[model samples]
Target: STGTMSAEELMKRGKRHLSVALKEECVNKNHVNLNIVLDHLLSKNKEIDDAETLEWCKSIIAGDKTYKEFLEIVKSYNNSSICGLVWTAEYVAYRCRTCGLSPCMSLCMDCFKAADHDGHDFNMFKSQAGGACDCGDESVMDAKGFCPKHSKNKDRSKIEPPKDLLFVAEIMIPRLVVRLVQYLRHSGAEKQYISKMTSFISFLQELSETGDLMQQIFSNVFTSQNDYTTYMISKSDVGVEYDIYEASLKFDTINVNKYFPELADDLIHKTLLDEMFFWVIKSKFPEHLVTFLLSILPNEQYKLAFVEVFVEHYRCMMVELTHSEDKSSVSNSVVHISVQLLSPLKLAIEIVTKFHLIHIMFACLKHIINQARYGNTLNLTSNVMKEHCYWPIVTDFINILAHPPIVQYFLNSTSLVNAWADVISSLQGLNMNRREHDLHVEFETETYYKAFSAELEICSTPLWALLKHLNDSSSKQLTINIVNILVTYLNKWFTENSVGEIEMNPDEMSFHYPLHRYLSLLISNALQQQGMELTDLLPSLEFLEILYLHPLHLLVREFFFFFVFPFNFVVGTYKICYV
Candidate 1:
C-alpha cells in the first residue's frame, strides 16, 4: 500500500503524525517547541531532510492551522512570554561576587564579568532574560592585564603639573557655551556666567604652554552679546550687525542639561560637542570656528582626531537610519544631517587643501563620496544630492579644484588624482554584475546608472564652467593655472609607466572630456589669430611637446594625431620660418 505513495505524499503523512505527537507530548509543557518538535519529527522519519525540517518550522512560525491549535492546548500560553525563551534560552548566569556566601553563590546571575573588573561582595545576582554564561573579572582572562591604576587619594601638592592644559580647556568651552546660553536674555546671569568662564579660561591660559592656541579656540565662544535680540528684531531691522555668533548661541534652557551636564562627563561632552558641531554649521556661524578648532590642534594627529570625530558622527547617524523602520523620520533625519554637514565639510576641504594636508583631505572626501554612492536607506544619496543646497557644497569643492595653488599641488603628485579617481572607480564596482555574480549584491543596473549619471554631472559641472570662462581677457592667470593643470594630467597619461589604452573613443564625443573639449577649447582660444601670440602659447606647447616626445601612452599619441597634429602642421611651418 505504501509503494504507490510519492515523496510529497510521504511528507504530508509525516507532518500529520508529527502534529498528533506534538498535541500528545508538548501540551502543558513550556520548552523549546521548535527544537523539540524538530526532534520528534525526525525520531522515526530518517528520510526527512534538513530542508524539509526548515520548511516545516517556517510554516509553524507563520501560524499554521495545526500550530495554532497546539498553542491553544498549552497552559497559560502567551506568545511573547514563550517566544523569548524559545528563540534565545532561559536562565542567564554571571560570576558570583562571594565565593562561598551561599551554595548558589558561584551560580548567581547578573554580575559584571569583564576580565579586569575588580571583585566585590554581593548577595542575589541580577536576572537576565536568556541563557548567557559569565566568567570571572576580565583580569582573569587578559594576560597583559589592563590600564594602570592611579591612586585616587594621591595628593596633588607633591605631583608636578602636566604641561598640556588643552584637554581641561576643551571641556570648559562647551560647558561655558551652555552656561552662557542658559542665561541668554538675562544680562545679569549671562554676565556672571561669562565672568566665571573667563576666569577659568584665564587659569587654563596660565597653565598652558600653548596659551595662544587656547585663546584662539575660545575667541568666539568668549564673545558675549544678546542672542535673544535677533528674535526680538523685526525683518525690517536691516544694516544692523546682529551678532550672528551670539544668534547661534541660542539653546533650550530646559533641555540643554540633557546635552551638557554641569558636572564633568566625557560622554556628555562628546554628545554635546557632536550636536554643537552640526549646530554651528546649520546656524551659519563663521567657518573660522571650524578652522580655529582644527588649527588649534595643528599637528596631523589632532587634525585627524577631529576628522575621525566628524566621520564617526556621520557614520553613526547613517547606521541609525539603516536599522530604523520609521520611513518618514529616516528621510527627515538624513536630510537634516546631510545639509548640516555640507558647509562644514566644504570648509574642511578648503582648509586641508590650504595646509597641503593631502592624505587627510583624501580620506575625508573618500568617506563622503563612498557613503553618497552606495547609500540605500530611504534613497538617502539621491535625495541629499538632489537638494538645491547640496550643489553649493559641491561647487565650493569645485572652486577649490579651480584654485591655482590647490591645482598645482594636486598636479605635482599623482596620489591625489589617483585617490579621487579611485573614489569614482568604486561606483563602477557597484555596476559589475556582468563581470561577477553575487547573490547578495543590492546594487542593480538602475542603481548604477543613477549613481554614474550623478557622479559624471558633479565631476563635470565646475570643470565645464571654468573652461567656458577661460577665453576672457582678464582670465590670463586663471588660464595659465588651467593650462598647468591640464598639462599635468595629460603628461601622466603619456608617461611610460601609464597603461596605454584609448580611454575615450574618437567617435563618441558626448562621453569624452577632461581631454577632448578642454583641449579643443584651449587650443582654439590660443590660436595666433585669436590674440594669443605664439609666445603666449609657447609654455603650453612646450609642455605638450614634452608629452609628445615620450610617445608611450596610446591616448596621448592618438590625441597628438587627432587634435595637436593639425595645429602643429599649420602653425609650426610659419613659426619655424620665423625662428
Candidate 2:
C-alpha cells in the first residue's frame, strides 16, 4: 500500500498522525514517553508498516534525532514547496484574501508568482517586521490558495488533538507542582535549597522565552473562567458583591487563591515567610527570594508581614549597633541588609506611608545619634566613623529621604523640623571635639575633613530643595521653622568659634562652610516666597550682622554679603546695624 504513495504524501500522513498522537489527552495527561506514543500510533497506522519507514519513524521516536534536529528536518520538508521567507519592514509581500484564514497570513513575492490567483482575491503590500510567508501553512491558508508544490495533498479535514497528550500534560504538571512544593517543604542544606530555587527560576525563565506557551498552560491548566467565577461567588457570600471588572483590575489580590489554590495554604505561606526571613538574615540571594515571594504573595497582609519583619530586624540591628560598646565587633552587614530589604518598598508609597517607615527611620536616626552624643566620644575620623557605622547608617537614612514619597511623608510630619534640627545639632556637637590638634590631624590626613564637609552638604542640600519645593504651598510656617533651625545653628557656630580659631584651622571652616552656604540659600529662597518679609528674616539678618563684625573667612563673609545685600535692596531696605 505504501509503494503506491509518493514520499511527500507519506510524510504528510506521518506528520498528521504524529501531531494527533502528540495532542492525545492520554499522552499529555499520563506523561507518556514519546517513543511509546509513536509506537502505539505506528501500530495503529498501517501506512508506515513497511520496514524502511518503520525504522525511520522509530529512529526519530527513540531520541536518536534531537528535538532540534527533528524540527529542522520537518522544517526542511515544509519549506521545500513554498518560500518560507520572512520580510523586514518596507519589503513587498502578497496576501490571498480568498485563501487566507487570518489577516496575518502572507506570502513571498516568488511564492505568490508561482501560485495561481487568476480568479482569486489577492493584494500586495509592504511587509512589516517579522512578516513571514504562510503559503504552505494549512492552518493559516486555505487549500485553494496553496502554491502548486504544497497543493499536491487534497485532504483538508481537521485533525482532532489527541487525548493522550492532554493526559501526559496533566500528569507532568501536577508532578512538577509537587516537586516545587517538596522543595519548599523539605530543607536539606543551604546549598541544595539555593540550587533548587535557582534551577526553578531558570526553568521559569526558559519557559517564559517560549512565546505564549506559559500563558496557554496557565490559562488552560492552572486556571479558567469557571474558577474565577467560583472565587468571586465565594467572596460574594461574605457580603462582597462580585464585580468582575473590579475583580479583574485587582487580580493580583485574588490570583494566588484562584490560579494556584494549593499555594495559598497557610503552611505554604508560613514556609515562604520563614524562607524569606532566613535568606534575609543569611544575606543569601535575599533580593531574588523577596522578588519571588512578592510575586506570589501580592496580598497587602503578606507585604505588611514582610514589612514588620524587616522593620523589627532593622530596629534590633540599629539598637544593637548603637549600644554595642565594641563598635569594631559590631557588623553593619545586617543593617545594610535591612536597608536593602526595605529599599524596594520605597516604590510602594502606600505601604511605606501606611507602615510609618519614615517615622521608624527617624526613630532609628535619633537612637543612633543619641547613643553617639551621650554614650561615646563621637569621632569624626574616617576609620572611627566607619567603625561606629555612623556615616553609613545616617547616609542610608538620608538616601531613603531622597525618595519623594518618603520625603513628603517626612515633610508632612509634625516632627520634621525638630528631627532635622536634632540631627544638625548632633553633628555640630560631634564635630566640636574634632578641633583638638590630634583629632584634626587624624581628620585631615584621612581626608575626613572633605568627607565631613560632603556629609554636611548632602544633609543640607536636600533640606534646601525641600524648602524651595514647599515655598509656594501653604506650608509657610514649615519654611520658617526650618529657617529658624538654620539661623540657630549659624548663631551657635559663630558664637562658639572665634575668628582666630577659624584662621588657625581653615579645615574647620571648610568643614562648616557647607551649612553656612546652604543656610544663606535657604534664607534667600524664604525671602522670595509670598507672605515672607524682612521681619521673618530678622534672625537670619542678625546672624549675618554677627558674621559681618567678625573677621570671618573671606569666602564666608563674601557669601553672607552676596546673600544679604540683595535682600536689603529688594525687601524694603532694612538697615542691619553691624555691631
Candidate 3:
C-alpha cells in the first residue's frame, strides 16, 4: 500500500489475489469479487489454458518486462501496472540498433514510417530515413538531417530521428508488434502511451505477420526447407537419398553460427519447426550433402538439434493427420527435407497426453480401418505390414496419447471410439485377406469393457484426479458418450474376433463398440503403449474396478457399466486391483 493505503488492506488484497490467481489465474472464474474486477478488464473472455499462458510467457521473453511481472504477483506494483508498462516500453524502444537505425530513431520499418530511400535491406541507412523522415521532420531540426558536423553533404537526403526527450511515452512503447498486444491488455502505461503504442503495434502486426518481415525474421528460427533436408538425411530413411549424397559434396560451407551470434542466440526447438521441415522435404533439399555438412559439427549443435525436433514432430503430425478433414500433399525435395527433420517440436506438443499416445495410435488404426471399409483394393494388408516408419509412428502416437492434454482432447471426443472401430475394421480386413499370416490376437470388444474397470479408482488419486469428475452425476453426457463409445467398440471388436466377420463396416456412419471386454482391452493396450502399469494411472486399478462393475458407479454416473469386471483382468497379466 502507498499514500493513504494501509498495510492491513494490502494483506487482505494479497490473500484474495493469491486465491484468484490459483483458481482463475488470468481467466475469469466468476468468483464474485474476483470476477467483477476481472470482467471490468475484459478478462472473462480470455481462454484459460496452456496456450494462453505460453503466449503470455513469450511476450515477456520477447523482452516485455511488464508481462514478466504479470506472471508474478499482479498486486506487486502499487495497485497498478502502469509503471511496469512504461518500463517495458523503454526497454523495447532500444531495439533501434537491430533495426539499423540511429539511437534517436522512432519510426519503424514494420510501420513503414521509417522506410529508408537508400537500397539498404536492413543495412545501415544511406540517408537517415529515421523517425518521421517520411513526414520530413529533418528540416525542422535544422533541415540538415544532422548537426553541421554530421552533415557531410548538403544534397544528401535525410530523416529526423525521434528526439531523446524526457517523456513517459518513449519509455513505455513496446518495440515489437506482439509486445504491443500484451501492452494493451496488460500494460498499465498512461492513456496517451497506450493509445499510441496500440495503434503502432497493431499496424505492424498485420503487415509484419507475413510476407518479407516474417520470411526474413523467421527463416532460420523455425523449420525451413534446409532444416528438413538435414533431418531426413540424419534418419537414414529410404526413397530420399539424394540430400545425403548431395550434402556429402558440399562439406566446405562456412558456419553461419560463427559470423552471426544472433543466429545461435535465437535458436529454438518447437513442433512448428516441422512446418519448415515439411516444406523442405516436399522440395527435396539435399540430404546426403546436408548430413555431410552436419557431420563436421558436434552432435549437440543446433544444426543437429533442429533435425531431432523435426523428426519427432513428423511422427506427431502424421498421427494428427487422422483428425484432419483432408489429406496432405505429396512429398518432394522440400517434403523430403522436412520428413526426417528434428525429433519433435517441443512447442505446445512437448507434453505427453494423459490418455496415452497408444490410444490415439489405435484411433489411427481405426482410420486405416475406415479407409479399408470403403472398398479400395490397394492390397493394404501386405503393404502396411512392410511399413517400418508406420509402426514407430503408431507407437509414438500411443505414447503421446497418454499425455494429459492429448488424452483429455482424445477421450473427450466421440471420434476416439470411432477411430478405434476403424482400427478393428481394418484389422478384420487384414485377417480376412490373410495373404501372409495371423496379424493380432483377437480380443472381442466385451473383453475391453472388462478391463475398463481399472479406471474406477483413478479418481481417488491426484495424477488423473481431473478425470474423476467424469464420474459425477453432472457429467451425464460424458458418461453416456464414454459408455456408448466403449460399448460400440466392443461389438465391432467381437465381430472381428469371435467370428469370421472379415467384411468391412457398412457405411460412412460413425463406429461404436458394444463390448465391455473390448473397452478394457483398448484401455489395456493404451496403457501398455504408454509403457505404464495400470496402477500408474490415477483412480487406482482397484477404484476403476469398483467403479466399472459396482452398482454405485452406474447410479452416480450417466453411463451404465456393461458388466462386472473382477479385480482379475481378462488379459490376466495385469491385476486390476494392483498394477
Candidate 4:
C-alpha cells in the first residue's frame, strides 16, 4: 500500500522492502513485493544496471532463482531505467466485477467495495491475476449510480474546438504558433504543462517541415475537404420548404469582419504584427521563430523577409497618417505609429552586431522624431509628444544606451557614437515658432539631460568605464564628448529652479558625488601620467587658476593622487599676519 506518500517517501519505503526481501530469502514467495522493490530501486538509483535487474527480477518472479542468487546477478542501472519502471503495468491478483448497463467490468480490489460506486452488483474473484480497469470503476457510475458518459463524448468539446477563428483562411503556420503561444500565456497554465504543450507543438512544427501538406494547411486553412470556400449561405429558396439540411454544404462568403467594425481590415494586419513580437515578452520561447529574428546573424532569407514586412507596414501607416486631416488623430497616431515601428528596433539595440545596423535604426528614429515635430509645427497650441505614450519609448531607448554591453560597444566603435551624437544634435536644433517652442522647450532640455544622466548611470557610472580606457590617447575626442555630455547634464541639474543658491541634501551625495569623484580621479591620473603640470590637463590656464583657488578642490584632487593638500598653513599664516 503506497498510500498518499510522495515519490521520495515511496522510494525510501521500497528500499527498506528490498532489504527485507533480500535478508529473508523470500523472493520466490513474494514476487509482487520483489517487483516493486526492484522497480523502485532502479528508479531511485540510476547506476544500478537495468538490463541485469530486469533479467534478474524476471528470473526470480518465475522461481528460477533465489533472492541471494538474484542479488549477485544484478549490478547497475542507467537513467533510462527510471522511465521503464514507471511505464510497466502491474497485474492485479484479485478480481471484482460490477453489474452495469454496458457489460461486466473487472476492477482491482479497492474499487469492489468503494462506497462511491453504490447500488451495483459486485462479485470478487481471488488470485486471478488480471489487469484492472485503469480508469477506475467510478468512471462507469457516479456517486449516485448513474451511468457516466465515456470521455470521448464528454471531452469532444475540448478535443475539437469550434473552427471560428477570424481570418482563419489567411493565418500562416507562424501566425498560428504565435496565437497559441499567446494563448498558453493567457491561460495561466502550470510551467510543466506549458513545457509539454510547447514540446508537442514543436514536434508538429517539425513534421510540418517535410512537404506540401504543411504548406497547404497553412496557405489554405479556409478550404473544406472538397472545396476552397470558407463560408456558407442557405441555397434553398427563402419561402420554399426543402430538405437541404441533409446535403453537405461548402462555404461561399465571409462577413465576420463586417460585424466587427472597430477592428476592420487593418485588424488582420495589426494581429499579425502584434503576434510577430512574441519574442519581446518574457514567457515566450523565442528560439523557433521569434528568436531567430533576434539573432545577430539570422538566416539571410528570413532577415530580408522580416525587413520587407516591417518596411511595408511602416509605409502603409505613413500613407494613412498623411491623408488624415484631424489634428488630435495625427498627434495620437504619431506616437502610436512610432511605438509600433521602434519596439523591434529597441529590442535589437543591445543584440545588434553591426554598426551599420545601429546607423539604420537611428535613422528610423530620427525620421520618426522629425516627422512628428514637423506635422504639428504650424499649430502653436499643439505638441508632438504625449508624455505617457511617447516618453516610454524615449525612456526605453535611454535604458538601452545605458546597458553595459551597448555602452562598451559605443566606446569602442567611433562610428556608433558619432551616429548617435548626430541624432542628438539634430534634436537640439529643431526649428519652431517661439510660442510653440516655449511650450516644450523645458521638456526638450529635460530629454537631453535624461539621456546623459541615463548614459552615465551604466553599472553606476560611465566614468568608471571611461577611466579604464582613458590611457588610449586616440579616443581622446570620444572621451571629451562624453565628458561634455555629463557636464551639460550636471549644469542642467544644478541650474533648475533658478535659485541664487541651490541646496543639495548631504545624504543624497551618493547619487551625484560619484560624477565629481570619478572626474577628479580622471584629471589627477591624466596629469600624473603625462608627466606635465596641471596646466596641461586643464582646457586652459584660467581653469587651472580656479582649481588652484579652491582649497577643497585641491584637497579632493590630492586625495585621489594618494596625498593631502596642506590647508592648515594658509589659515595659520593669515592669523599671524593679522596679529
Candidate 5:
C-alpha cells in the first residue's frame, strides 16, 4: 500500500508525521518544508542516525528558529540573572539522571523550571554544597535535554584555535610526553613503575569511596563537571586511566629534574620551558592542564627551574624591546603576558627574589618611561604610554612588590632604588610639558595623574613596612625621592583646583593625608635621632604648613594626635619662636 502511494502523497504523509513527532501547534507548510530539507541534508551526510545530531536537528526544527536565532536565545538565557545561580543546601535543586554527565552537575530551581526536561529521569533534592547550574553547558548535557529557552547548535568543525597554541598543545606537549615515555621504556624500572602506578590508582579508588579526596582530585583535574564530560568524551578511545598512568610514569622518575633542570642551558629543556612560557603567555591552557604541567615538578627545585625559565624569557623580551630602534613594533603583549605569569608567583618570594624579578620589573618600568618621554610628539602621554603598556606594567609590578619579602628586597637593593629613581626622574621630565587645552590632552593628563596617585597609595604599604622594619636605618634618598614626588603631586592638585572646591569626603582626602603623615613621621623620627636639630624641621615644617592649609586639614587633624604629635609639638615650638 505504501509503494502504490503517489510521490506528493508520500511527502504529505512525511510532513504530517514530522509535525506530530515534533509536537507542532499546526501543520505549517514552511515549517514542514524546513524540517524536510534539514532531514534530507542530515540523512545525506549520514548524521541522521547519530543520536546527538538527530537531537540537535529536532530541537532546531521544532522551535522553527534559525541557528543565529537559537544562539541569541542561548546568549539571553546566559545573561539572565537567576539562570546560573549556584544552589546551596538551603535550596532545593534538580538533577536529571538521564542528562547529567556527573553527580556534580545540578541546576538551580529557576534553571530547572526554564529548561525542558519533563518526562526525563530527574531527582529534586536539597543540594549539599553550592552546585552550579549545568543547563546550557553543551559539553556535559545533550542538546535535546536543553529547554526551549537556551538552545545552541555548534559546528565543531568550524572552530579554529590560535596556531601558536595549537602547535604548543597538539604538537609540542605531546612530543615532550612521548619523549619522556620513550625514556621511561629504556629505564630498568619499568615493572616497578607500573606496580607503583597500579598501587597509586588503587589508593585513589579507595579514596573515592570516602568522596572528599576523590572530589578534590576531580576538581583539580577538571575545573567543572562539563570539563570532565568533555575530557571523557575526547579521551574515550584512549582512556583517561592509561593517560594518568603514563603521566605518573613520566614524572615519577628520580631523574625527572634532569629533563627540567634549574638552568636553561640544556637545549631540549630550554625549548620545552620556552614553549611552556609561551603557553602561559597565551593563557590558552585550561586550569586542569596548568595543574597537570605543575605536577611534573616533583619538588621545589623543579618548580624553581620553571620560574627561572619564565623570568629569563621575560628579561630577554624586555632587553630586546628596550634596544629596538622602532620600539612601536614591539608588542605590548609582552608586558601583559609577563604580568600574567609573574602575578601568580607573588608568594614565591624565594624564587622571585633569588632571580631579581623586582629589579627586572623596575628596569622595564624605566624603559617604558624613557620611551614615553622621548617618543614622537614629545608629550603624547596617553597614546605612547598606553602603546607600551606603561601604567598596567608599573601598577602590576607594584602589586607584586607589595608582598613583605619582596618589599624588603626592594628596600635593601640600591640598584632597585636607582632604577626607581630613574623612573621617577623620567616621570618628572614628562610632567614638565606645558598644559594643553585639547580635551584629549587634558583627559590623558588627568589619567596619568590618577594612575600616579594610585601608585603612590600602593607604595605607602611598602613605605610603612620599610619604616617599621628599618626605623631610621631605611634609605634616606629613597625617602627624599618619595617625598619630592608627593610634593609634585600636591602642587599639581592645588594648581588644578582651589582648596575650597575640594571634596569633604575623608576617603577623597586620605591621599593628601598620607604625604603629611609620612613627612611628619620622617621629621619626628629624624628629630628623635641624635645630631638632628630644630633647623632640620624648618624645610619639613614649611612643606607641612602648605599641606595643612589644604581641604585635607580636617582629616589630617583627626589623625594628627596619633601619628604626628611629635612633629606637631615641634611645629608648635617653632611657630612660637618665629611667628
Candidate 6:
C-alpha cells in the first residue's frame, strides 16, 4: 500500500483524473494543460520527496483553487498547437520513519534501483498504518529504530536520567496510569476522578510543594504507589492486578535539561535534605516527574531547594573552607564504599537542569580534585583511573548538555571549554550555520579550536591520572569506560548533523573542528592506551557501523547495562585475580 507503489502508478492515477482536462484543452485554443497537470500531480502526491517535482506540483497548486480550475488550464493547453502540455518532475523530501533519512522519493525506475527499494515507510507518516508507534519502537536507523543520529547516543544517556525515568520506572507509571484511569472510569472512584484532587495529583511532581504536612502525605503515597507498581510489574501480572486489584491514575523528550529550572536554593534550609536526597538518589525518577518539576521550576521556588541541596552536599563532600570534615576524606570514602552513590542524585539533578546544580557540583569537583592530592591514592600497576571516582567525572558530560538549547548556548558563548573541552567542542554549533554568527565569531572559533586540541591531548595521555594511583593493578572496567567516552564522542560528532560532521572532519583545513572525532579516531587507533586487548570494547569502526542504523537502538540498553552492571563484575574479577 505504501512503498510498493511506483511513480508511474501515481502518474497513471493522476493522469486518469487529468483526462477530463485533456479533452477540454483539445476543444479550446487557450493553453493551460501544464498548470492543470501540476495541480493533479500535487493533489495525488503530497509526501513525495522529488524536489523538482514537488516545486512544480506546488506551483500548480498555487495556481488553482480546485480541480475544476486546474482542469480548465489543462483543457486550454491542448487547443494551443505548440504549447508544452505534458511535463514530469520528481518531488524530493520524503524521509524514512526508521532512519529519518530521505533517500530519493522519485520514480527513477531504470538507473537508481536502490531508490525503489523499501527505503521509506510511508506508513509511519500516515494515520491508519502507523497505528500507535510507541517509545519502544526504536527502528528508524540501521540497527536501531532511533534515528542514525541517535544510534550512537550513549552520551545522551549520561544526562543522568531523571529520577522517575520512564525507562527505569517503566512498569510502574503506565500501570498506575492505567489503573488510575480505569478506577476513575468505574463505579465508585468516578467522583474522585472528576475531583480537583485527582487533577492536581495527576500532575504531582515534587510533593515538596504541597506544604510540609501534605508533602509528607504525598511522599508516602508516591513511594507506596510507585513501589506497588514496581512489584506488580516485576511479577508479570501487572495488568490484571491494576485492573481488578487496585485503583489509581497517572501519566507523563527533548534536550529537556536546558530549559528545566533549578530547584529552590533553600532546599537545604527548608526541607529535610536527607529525606529528599534519598528519594532522588534511591531510584531513577519517572519522566513525568522530571518534566513536571522542570515545567514548574522555571517559575517556582522549588528549584532553590534543589540547588541548595546540591551545593550543601558538595560542600560536605569537598568544600575545604566550610567548617566541615576534610573534603578529601569523603572523596576517598566515596571511592572505597563499593557502591554507586553519586549517580542517582546526579541523575535527578541532571533531569531538572543540565547546568542546574552543575556550577555547584563542578565547584565541588574542583575542590575534590584539589583535595585528591592529600588522599591515599591507590596503588596501580599499568591501569590508571581504576578507582570509582574517576568514572563519574569522565562519563556524564553528555547528560550535562543533552538539551540542545544549552548546546546552542555553548556554541554561542565565547567562553572556552575549561574542563570537559572535548565534550563542549564536539556538540557546539551543531546544525547552526543558519543562526546569525556573533560578533565574537572569531574568538569563539579560536577558543573552540584550542579546547578541541586540549581534548585531543587528554585522549592521548593522562586518561588514567587517578587510576594510575591504584599502583599498577589493572582494571578492564576503567579501561573500557575511558574508551567508551571517546567512542561516544566520535559517534555524536560524526552522526549529529551535517554541520557537526563537517566541523568534525579531521581532514578539515580549518583550525576549528569538532572535539570528539579526533579523540575517537585517536582513541580507536591507540587502543593500547586504554590497555584493552582487541576484544575488550568493540572497535570504534564497528561501534560506528552499528551506531546509526536499524535495530541497534536496543544497543542503548546494552550500553547502559555495560555502564551499570559491568563495572561491578569487572572490578570483582580484577580484584579476585589480584588476590
Instruction: Tell me the tens digit of each residue's lDDT in model 6 across 292-364.
Output: 3222221213334444444344333322212122323333232211111122233334433443434443434
lDDT tens per residue, model 3, 1-579: 123323233224543343333233223222333223222222213432225333432332222233334324222211210010111111222122233222223222332222333332333232211112211223112222232222334243333322221011111111121132223223222333333333333323332222222222322333344443443333343223334333322323222233222222122223224333332232222232222222211112333445454433343344333332322221122132332221123311432232123343443343333343435322333322223213334433433333344445655666554554344333321211111122443654432332222122111121133243333334444434554555554444444343222422211111121234334543454354434444433344443443344222222221111222432432242223224
**Local distance difference test, each candidate:** 0.36, 0.44, 0.30, 0.33, 0.42, 0.31
**Tens-digit lDDT track of model 1 for 461-537:** 64554454454555555455545555555555445323233333222211222343354466566562245654664
* Candidate 2: stretches off by over 4 Å: 1-197, 200-271, 274-278, 284-348, 367-377, 381-384, 387-408, 429-443, 447-450, 453-458, 471-474, 484-510, 513-519, 529-531, 537-579
Which candidate wins on lDDT?
Answer: 2
Q: Weakest 10 consecutive residues, lDDT, candidate 2?
A: 248-257
lDDT of 5: 0.42
Best-fitting candidate, scored by TM-score? 2
**TM-score attained by model 5:** 0.35
Residue 470, candidate 6: Cα error in Å is: 36
Q: What lDDT, from 0 to 1, does candidate 1 have?
A: 0.36
Instruction: Tell me how many residue pairs clash in candidate 5.
Output: 1
Worst 10 residues of 3 by lDDT: 80-89
Report the lDDT tens digits of candidate 4 across residue range 233-341.
Answer: 1322211111221110111222222332222223122222232332122222222333222221112233233443433333233333333344333323333222222
Candidate with the larger TM-score of 1 and 6: 1
Q: TM-score of every model?
A: 0.29, 0.42, 0.27, 0.30, 0.35, 0.23
Better of 3 and 6 by lDDT: 6
Number of clashing pairs per prediction, in order: 7, 29, 122, 7, 1, 71
Candidate 1: where is the Cα deviation over 4 Å? 1-176, 179-275, 278-363, 367-393, 398-448, 491-517, 521-579
Which of 1 and 2 is ahead in lDDT? 2
State the lDDT of candidate 5 residue by residue for 1-579, as single tens digits.
213333344345453354343333223222344334343433322321244433443343324443334334333322221123333234687888787653344666776777778788999887432334556555445666665444564322333322221111121122223222222222222333333223222222232222222223322332223432332224444344335433432321112122223323221222333433433322322222233333332222333455666565554445444444444433333432333234333324744567656555555555455455654122434454544444434544654654445556665555565445444433332332232323333244454564455335334444554555334534444445444554655555445445435543332222223444455665565566423454634445645555566623443434442344554664565446434
